[model samples]
Target: MMTTTSEIDSIKKYKTNELIDLLRKEDLELYTEDLEIIRKQKINGRDFLNKNKEEFRNIGFKLGPALRLKEFAEECKKRKKRFSSYKTKKEVVLTKFGIDNSIKNIPKFVPQTINISDDDDEFQYCIREIKRKMEIIGPARSSNEAVRCLYIETILVSAILIVKRIVREKIFLEPQREIVDEEATG
Candidate 1:
């Protein structure tokens, strides 16, 4: 899901037209800066992959076929997906300088291993250990750590959605909907 501030959802649910009007009233520079950060992150991820093509082959062993770093980098560059404001022309324009400087500071890779002593509950123990390690070491490192954090966040968000669905079913309540009355004039 696209990242939106909590206030945006409140505004969307209660006062959508007012939110649009507010958007028009605000200076575009704030939006532009937000877009720039997104752009830099994408570019950084792409560049990291490009710089360590061989290392990514090792990472692919653990991460599997879904994320091939080299290919992802190439795709990012080709799509020019770095800049968030590209889709919305009203946002400010900054000179494209390839990847951001902060990306260069991050390490390309970190070593990790999964230790399984016996076949008894091996799968369950491994999963538990992995989760534990993720919590402990996730924020301490850079580059690969950041990517791992993103994956963890994605999994957590998906799990939350699943739990929300289950709870909604258990409660026997209808899902909330926002109704817009286009015909109503004040």
Candidate 2:
């Protein structure tokens, strides 16, 4: 689901237009800066992939697929699919930028094979692991510009979805429509 009111059944009472309006007003510059910082700090997509492409290959996602990630997220919600993968993707974004998204006890459950300790910040752990793999590259390899562009775009779009959710949750401070209407007439 979009996590906004229009799509999710639980919050169906909320008007979609209102939520979208509030979202449009949020400080998106913070998110944009965070993404830019990630871009500056990281090895570019080509280098990262050249080193650890196998780590991502088994993810089984078809690059350059016609459907958007939001559509895929909606389908997952509809089917009640385990969000382990979604959460993993989110964690990677958070780690890459060292953001602390402290949401816990997410409603859905998925069986995870890896043992994780309560003290471990999974986000930072993932960041370090990927960095290590990149640092250990055997030889420099040629880059495919088209695939790299697609990879970067996909990850950035995914991060945008996560940022949108955060903004929506925090946007409740906005005045209600009735309040706005009253102020306008006054």
Candidate 3:
């Protein structure tokens, strides 16, 4: 959303240092005032609301990267497998059997294993590994177990939505650049 002159002026009423400090502290009072300033400035209602919505969404967005872990854990639970230790090379191979069995029982549980992996790569690699394993196991039953699985899936989906919203806002709401006549002799 575009920041209007009046909004800018209102924001200016607070000392720059104070504003910076408040932002750092995540002071809700200052946030409320900022919202009021934006409202008074007659900024586009839709854009303002969208921006505010995304601002709220940002809180949940950070959790997105972590959802893969949760989903993997849930999938393991659904297949009656424990998501335990894998610190050593031997542990990985031994644990693979239980994971494979779980996958065999619940195919959907197979893909979920794709989410797991070594620490060297992005943490998401572990999540991807879990997911891959889940796919191999096949689809899960649509009973009580399914209900619990759905609940976990919902949380993961929410996380993904939060991340998407944050990315969209960052890409679209960033300030535009002004053209400079550098080529012309000053």
Candidate 4:
């Protein structure tokens, strides 16, 4: 699939913010007017996910955009379901290999939260360690478990690469906070 936007909020239970974010994806080909109509109609994320093609047409969507939107929503829904089903088991397996969930807030695959900062050299080191551990995954007794481990590691590395590229491009800037002058306050 062509990755036109980050998957930051992909697997979460969707709400108004999530709905608007989904609409903002460039591949959706929706206009601001279309977004206004959705807002005016009070079409929340759940409504967006559940509405079929006919229902979307009834809501005044053009055929092409409607189909694309529906497909996108279904894909997100599938990812959410897949993540939820293995949520606990994934944690246990990661923990067994001394992996902790330090990575958080990444909007990418692996179905787990990942947070990386521009200056996070430690994260790069952590990725290396994860890769090292993955070599041991092949010798595990259960093929199924080994496969899952390898899959997770691959996804994790891919997510990190994406993040690193984003950082390099200056696309993922940290939020700016206003610096208050102590002298002025005093």
| Candidate 1, residue 87: how far the Cα is off, in Å | 13
- Comparing 1 with 4 on lDDT, the higher-scoring candidate is 4
| Regions of candidate 3 where Cα sits further than 4 Å from its true position | 1-130, 133-137, 146-151, 154-186
Q: What overall lDDT, based on C-alpha atoms, would model 3 receive against the true structure?
A: 0.41
User: Which pairs of residues collide in model 4?
Assistant: 8-107, 103-114, 104-113, 104-114, 104-115
> In lDDT terms, how accurate is model 4?
0.63
TM-score of each: 0.17, 0.16, 0.15, 0.40
Candidate 3 lDDT over residue span 1-186, tens digit each: 223444334443554444434333532233444444434444332232223344433434234322432343233333332213224565465466655434444335443222323453334544564466467644445464544454455446544544555456533223224434665422
lDDT of 2 at 175: 25
Global local distance difference test of model 2: 0.38
List CA RMSD, all candidates.
Answer: 27.4, 28.4, 26.8, 20.4
Encode model 4's per-residue lDDT on 57-116: one tens digit a residue.
788888886787778777766765665566576677666666665445333566545566
Number of the top-ranking candidate, with TM-score as the measure: 4
Comparing 2 and 3 on lDDT, the stronger one: 3
Candidate 1's TM-score reads: 0.17
Candidates by TM-score, descending order? 4, 1, 2, 3
> Cα deviation in Å at residue 98, candidate 3?
52
Q: Which stretches of candidate 2 lie over 4 Å from their true place?
A: 1-141, 169-186
Q: Compare the candidates by lDDT and give the number of the best one.
A: 4
- Count of clashes in candidate 3: 34
Tens digits of per-residue lDDT for model 2, 90-116: 777666666656555343568545433
Error of 1 at 123 (Å): 78
